[model samples]
Target: MAHDHQHNHLVQMLDLDAEVLEDFHRELVGWAGSLVGDRPRVVDLGAGTGTGTLALARHLPGAQLTAVDVDDEMLEHLRHRAADAGLQDRIRTVRADLDGDWPALGPADLVWASASMHHLADPARTLARIRDTLRPGGAFMITELDGFPRFLPDPGLEDRCAAEMDRLRREGGMHMHENWGARLTAAGFDLAGERTFELEIPAPLPPAARRYAQVTFARMRERLADRLSADDLAALDDAAATAAHRDDLTVRATRMVWVGRRPS
Candidate 1:
């Protein structure tokens, strides 16, 4: 959650380019503007490091943005990011767990969750909550990984990942949800859409990129260490080391953007 090299680099390696993310927010703003007719309030859930938050602040002028995340350190970095971007006044950072009561945030015109929905214990319920937070006809958007796209080219690695994650979930007593599209529909979104991007990261990963991966893997292990068996932990470490050895590591993480309007 902190702006360690690994965290930031993994984002750069796996997530879309800032320009692409900016373009997306612009498109979403236009869509929301068509309904609300002007700059509208938006809430960015789990706005770690405030990259998206900064982008939204720049793109959505005259907009009130609340960047909500539970991590204080992440929020601290986000605050500086906002200040550096000269958006200190426009973006508000709130520390709260999404599983609990949301902060008195807003009748937001748009609620955007990027790569954060998967972390929610109940994604459908989270969608429903996001829907409730919106004004009438306001939009709730979720961006998630599409699954291992490049895994198809690699031999058994994709399957191995899928199996490992599944095993990890089962061993941890965690119910990991894969189908966000169906979940959104179940949460009362009629007009739903999804998109996939290859996100071809270059080989011999950039130092920042590699750091991101390492930090993320370490973070994940920290979260699961208590739940995982010793063998499981060792297996995960082995897999990570093996993954790091390859010349070209193509991670096929798709960004699924699902926007649903609350029924007016």
Candidate 2:
């Protein structure tokens, strides 16, 4: 039950990300579509909530997408979202752990991994596997976040929270900061393109953004319960409680994307 509850929060968070950052998502999907053929066979690694899968499907009507994730619950949620979007025909969900033996997902023309590669136990090996999964000259796109988005107007509290989160992630062995472009080259993929997006949505945020801020604060509060100082935890609690009602909130985030290609 606890796991399910956590998954629910994750689902809401991912979906809200797509919703609140609709422009960025659309631009990303368009850019990804530009790298492939009209009838490209795409694979979305760690496809949580089917955001990329469904977006790619809708953007490229002729594309076929396979959304793969280790969590059965995530896959189930993706399937349901695809069905709701009327993209079930073009999108299929596969449950497989990328850290272990990968299932046959290839000869794909394009493989997309968004904010998911950093979680792999061995990213280099996974990159090699992804190279093999794609056909010659096929493209692989990777997206990674610097950290969670910050919604506070004053940067002090959020900065402290981010530092604590970084410490926690580092101690927990997460690869949050990696030179992925160089890694792709070392993995024998030609670095095709790299871009970093800096997003800032100002005050008068939509209702969805407000809820997103609330959820993010709440999650941070829970995760940093023991890590943050007493005063910081209390501030987080107050922020989470009043986030939805705050008019001064702004969303700031940075995302980096790297594209690599299998040499023909």
Question: Model 2, which residues run further than 4 Å from truth?
Answer: none
| Candidate 2 lDDT by residue in tens digits, 1-264 | 755656677788899999999999999999999999889999999999889999999999999999999998889888988888898999888899999989999999999999899888888889999999999999999999999899988899899989998999888778898999999999999999999999989997889999999888877877788888899989988988898787999999899999999999
Candidates in order have lDDT scores of 0.64, 0.91
Query: What are the RMSDs of all candidates, in order?
Result: 5.1, 1.0
Assess candidate 2 and give its lDDT: 0.91
Q: Which candidate is the best by TM-score?
A: 2
Clashing pairs in 1: 6-211, 6-212, 10-212, 146-254
For model 1, what is the alpha-carbon lDDT of residue 109? 85
Ten-residue region with minimum lDDT total, candidate 1:
146-155
TM-score of each: 0.71, 0.97
Model 1 ranges with Cα > 4 A deviation: 1-37, 146-162, 169-176, 202-207, 210-247
